[model samples]
Target: MKILLTAINSKYIHSNLAVRYLKAFTKDLDCECTIKEFSINDRIEKIFEKIIEEKPNVVAFSCYIWNIEYVVKLSNLIKILDEKIEILYGGPEVSYDGEKFLSQNPGEYLIVEEGEETFRDFIEWKLGIGNLKINNIKGLYYKNEKEISFDGERKPMDLNKTVFPYEKDDELHNKIVYYESSRGCPFKCKYCLSSTTHGVRFMDVSRVKKELQFFIDKGVKLIKFVDRTFNCNHRFSMDIWKFLIDAKTDATFHFEISADILTDEEINLLNTAPKGRIQLEVGVQTTNNEILKNIDRNIKFEDIKEKVLRLEKNRNIKQHLDLIGGLPGETFDMFKKSFNDVYSIAPEEVQLGFLKLLKGSSMRFETEKWGMVYSPYAPYEILSTDSISYDEILKLKRTEEVVDKYYNSQKFGNILKYFMPKFESPFDFFFKLGTYFKNKGYLDRNISSADYYRIFMDFTEEILNENTEILSEIIKYDYLKFNKKKWLPTFLNRVVEKDIHKKIRTELKKENIEDVHVERFDIDILKYEICGEIVKDTKYVIFDENNEDNIKYFE
Candidate 1:
């Protein structure tokens, strides 16, 4: 019999680690097995054609919230094309409500919780190995003659027994490879599905080190750890960090960590690592203590703040901080305070997200009790609550857009740092900027990078009444840093005599500056400030070819 394990990923850059794991576990089963992956962006007809071309007897789909609806429709289409094709579905979206999913969809099997052992048993039974009975397989739900039956819960697999999913497949080379040093989460934050599972099981440190070396040897660009809290065990995490430092590959490892749980030793290790070697995603959902308590989140906001501030001091490690807009008992004002608090830390990126009431999460059950109303779709994002109305949420959504475009993009860092202090709070600055964009219809229209620069200039001149020349110079510097070409915005293009460049280069030669390109501008050399210190603009911006760190201006 032929078997196919497939997944519809959210993006092309993502590879389905689940399907790979299933195929790896059932590799020795006396059946021909293959793995196929497609993105949701792919046309359904094309996916249908590809699957039909495979002509497998058993087709197992690894489902998730993002791709469940598509999988259901595709399964129905496949059944129509060939009723003999056995259909199976499993993942967090269908694992909780297996019976309902089977009743509504065309799938014949649902593997719950840990699927490695259960899938192996089911495949063996289908291939008629050793008179194996499907009913005895734990963590499996199957439909037989229109009757849905389930086995008991399956025990979690020992990580040591599981083989590494990557098997020298050339397709995985350029994708964002996801690695798991550990399974399950230690903390039970109510909104997360990981909270439902108890205890954390780690793979053997030697196994993890081998896997890290494999990816590094492959020259993979990024390897994101799927561990819920990567730093939950400091020893395990630090060992991996040390291994990466020793390996010295160009690959960057990304981790989701709890800031409050980080030790000083771990901080020092991260601080000394090579720049861009590691990136951290710290979720500071909300700063409201009452909401944090209601959600059973054990984070101390003050401790998190202190730890994050220390992490920010490490120029090598890039940190991305997160804040959720909607949560229990959080009003708009309270959320603004939360936003302002997280914004003060100055992470490399600030991800403004809304609360998603996911399936099987404790927070989903408490929606009614907390007076929360959310969308009843796959993602189940919150629409409103008793404290925060829908209109307030909409306003926050606009503020989120501004934060993503301006603050998180890192393109406007200098100007934002300069202008944000003028407002009552950072939230006030972003909220007003969001409002300005909405009023000018820029929010609804398509905008280019150059247009964004022009819009920022207009905002500074008309709304904030700040010095446009200084703002333009800051933006020009930012543009040069990000963009490769020497294109300037129309407003910033000023005619300068050739003698000005000659004079600046002559002055720079005395300072031992060589191999530099000089451009003259219209701004006053002596009056402007760069990075909070008065510096001569000289109308001459010097770019040294060898040194990116040395961007000099001469009067």
Candidate 2:
């Protein structure tokens, strides 16, 4: 028997780890298992053709909001090509709205939460076992033309019981990295997908170490941890982290963590981790207390702030902070403050996202009351309503584009923070830039930092002209042209400049500066000294140059 697992990822970098987990579960089943991947950028019909070409007996599709539409379309094409090939779908996107979804989308079975064991049993039953029954399975919503049935909830596997005994398949390693530390989440964030998979469970520490060893032995460079809150269980999180720290493993592990829950001990352990060895993604959805309360996310803003700041000081862990724009009671101004506040923490990456009113989430139930009108399609992204205008939400989406380009992917933390406060709200600031690109026919759907910065600076100059303070603080921008004299005078006037300069000098000291050179620029009686290299004849003279007499000091 042959089984094929696949998904349509947003990018090769964004492939789903679910495929990996499924492969691990079915390795011992003795069925020939094959995995394939499709991306949104690929032509859908071609993907269908490829799947048909492989012609596996069973095709299991890993579904998500980003790729469900493509999956459904592909599934329909599969039915057209050959109805005999069994089709199955699973993942968070289809976990809810199962009955309706099953009715509309025929010829597919749904695997509910924690699919490893249940999917295996179902495959076995189909292989030739008579009197097959799905009701015994804990986590499945199976359907036939005559009836739709809900299987009893499947309990999560003992993490120790899960293993990837199959030979390492490096063929898919570059496209995706499979992962899972535990099942379910401990927090009840109203907007989250994992809330439905609550009650955090952990893998036996020894088994986790073994898995890490396997990936290392295979020379896999990237292993993404699918744990919703990696550090939620404290001791388990600590043990795995410490093991990785001690092993000094070459493979990189990416985790999504709730920063507020990080204890001092964990922070200390993380500090010892080698740079680029670990990447943490923290969700700082909003700073507004009222909004947080309304959404039932019980995290304290102050605690989150403190933990993030401490973690950042380590200089080892690469941090990514996340914020959602359309939440209950969060206006454009409130979101702006959230952006500026989170940006100030100086995470290596900051993601600006629009809210998705996922089916079965608490937000879905509250949307009508909260005045949310989301897209009626697969992902169901929130549009806007009385609480927030559609126009405003559109602006936030544009802002998200700019943020992804400049802040998140580009790694421009310093420059972005320096210019953050100029516009009343981050949405306004970035959306205006987003609009300029769209208007000029210059917007690259997949824009790069080089593409974005060029347009951003064009608009930024006008905004900076009105607020010189914003420009003055941007010490890194070359085009701003703040010579030492221009910058020093402004720096001296500020009350905090001394402390700021001290920090700069302290950091520079770590680099062990070999020398310092000062150059004086004098042209037609205008004379100035700038603290940097002097290579051109700009009526300038190096302080130690024999021609220093030619340049007079500026009065």
lDDT of 2: 0.71
Cα lDDT tens digits for candidate 2, 1-555: 888888788886665567766787877666877788778999998898899889888788888888888888888888888888878888888777766677688455788766778878877676645666666656777775568888667777776666553356455456436577787888887888776665877877788888788877777788788788899888998999888877756778899999988999999899999988899998889998888898888887788989988888977888998888888888988888888788778788888888888887887888778888889896788888556788888767777776776667544434555455566655566767677766766655665434444444456555454533333333223212222323333221223345544554565457673132232222221211232222333232122123322333212
The number of the candidate with the highest lDDT is 1
Cα lDDT tens digits for candidate 1, 265-325: 9998888888889999998999988888988987779999998888778578889988887
Determine which window of 10 residues in candidate 1 has minimal summed lDDT. Answer: 525-534
Backbone clash count for every predicted candidate, in the order shown: 2, 4
Global Cα RMSD, each model: 2.7, 9.0
Question: Looking at model 2, which ten-residue stretch has the lowest summed lDDT?
Answer: 520-529
**Could you tell me which residue pairs clash in candidate 2?**
138-152, 138-153, 138-154, 139-154
